[model samples]
Target: MTAEFAVALPSVILLLALLLAGSAAGVTQLRVEEAARGGARALARGAAVGEVGDIVRRLAGETARSEVALDGEWGRVTVTGRVPGAVGTLVPWVLSATAWARPEAPGAAIQPAVDGTSREARLGT
Candidate 1:
């Protein structure tokens, strides 16, 4: 029994460690995706590229990096961050996410519906 226990212990511990590392990587990936989405939204709202980068960093981690591209009415943001943990280091896991949005012109306001009734008016707000 002792021999069997000794043989299984290391395997169990290694499995647990791998599970933790995988979960950490998944969480980091979610953060990267969220950062990209937020950056895209900010860019679509006419925010400066620097501000979008800041938003991405804030939503992700300080070590995270972002890229922004604007082409005509389209905007794209990509965010990348390193996963945290020894396993991540061993595997060199780098998580990235990209999001796209249609940017409005600077100083352009949201247009009302075709019937000329505002959303608030329809909702009685």
Candidate 2:
């Protein structure tokens, strides 16, 4: 029994550590995604390009690096970010999200048509 426990302990510890790291990665990914959604919403409302970039940068912070791109005419926004792992790996994982919204059309103008002849005359003739 003692030999069996000793053999399994290292593997168990490694498994738990990996699980914890994976959970941390998942949380970081969720944060990055939320930041992207916020950036897109701001940009869709006709916010300035610089303002949108600043918003994303502030949201991402040191944990994740982020970039925002906007298509003003189409009202489309794309955000990309990289979330670093807890492990000291040099290559950070990348994630991206995009959103778009179209501006509502203005109400149409109502105009009345005119005729050269008087209204009663035109109606009768």
Candidate 3:
């Protein structure tokens, strides 16, 4: 019995390590997706591009990438990053995700200023 147990212990450990690797990758993917959606929403609401990037970096680490582009009324955000797991030496794939959002309206993003005028007005139309 002892010899059989010893023979199976390595297999058990390897299986457990694989499970941990999968869990880590899943968690990283979810985090990246969340950051992408949040950043996209903020951008659609008129937030600065730098701010959107900051939000993604803060949530998903410095290696993560974020981009926002406008298509008339819609915005798309893509987030990508590498997630190393418990068995990084053996994992050969990259994990990534993307999300999209649309602006509420044309002038909806315009903010009112202290001078009783819209920011768009201050910007000269």
Candidate 4:
């Protein structure tokens, strides 16, 4: 019984570790996705380019990277980052999330910037 237990213990431990890593990766991906969507919405509402990056970083994490650009009237935002692992050396992988949004009408309210400026002042609100 002892011999069998010893052999199976290692496999169980490894499986748990893999599960943990996968869970972390999934949560990180969700955060990145949320950040990207927020950034895209801000951009579409005519928020300043300078502020979009700040908003994404805050919503995601400081380690997250964001790219926002406008194509014609469409805006796209992409966020990429990696989740840290148990021993501090294993990065599961670099994950990316993206979102797209379209410009609103001039009479629409704008989104507030990271700096506390009202959407109305920014002219989207």
Best by lDDT: 1
Clashes per candidate (backbone, < 3 Å)? 0, 0, 0, 4
List of clashing residue pairs for candidate 3: none
Pick the winner on lDDT between candidates 1 and 4: 1
Ranking by lDDT: 1, 4, 3, 2
Instruction: Give candidate 4 misplaced runs (Cα > 4 Å).
Output: 87-92, 106-125
lDDT of 2 by residue, 15-104 (tens): 987787677667766666676666556655655545555676666554444443323344444555555555525445666665554433
Model 1 residue pairs with clashes: none
TM-score for each candidate, following the candidate numbering: 0.81, 0.62, 0.76, 0.77
Task: Tell me the tens digit of each residue's lDDT in model 3 across 1-63.
Answer: 999999999999989988888887888888888888887777678766667778888877777
In the range 36-118, model 4's lDDT, one tens digit per residue, is: 88988777777875678878888888888876555545667788878868822465488888898777776543344345443
The per-residue C-alpha lDDT of model 1 at residue 41 equals 86
lDDT (C-alpha) at residue 79 in model 4: 85
Q: What is candidate 4's CA lDDT for residue 13? A: 98
User: Candidate 1's residue-wise lDDT over 5-123, tens digit each?
Assistant: 99999999999999999899999999999999998888778776667777888899888888765554676787888998888888988898989887567655433223443221111
lDDT of 4: 0.73
Comparison by lDDT, 1 against 3, better one: 1
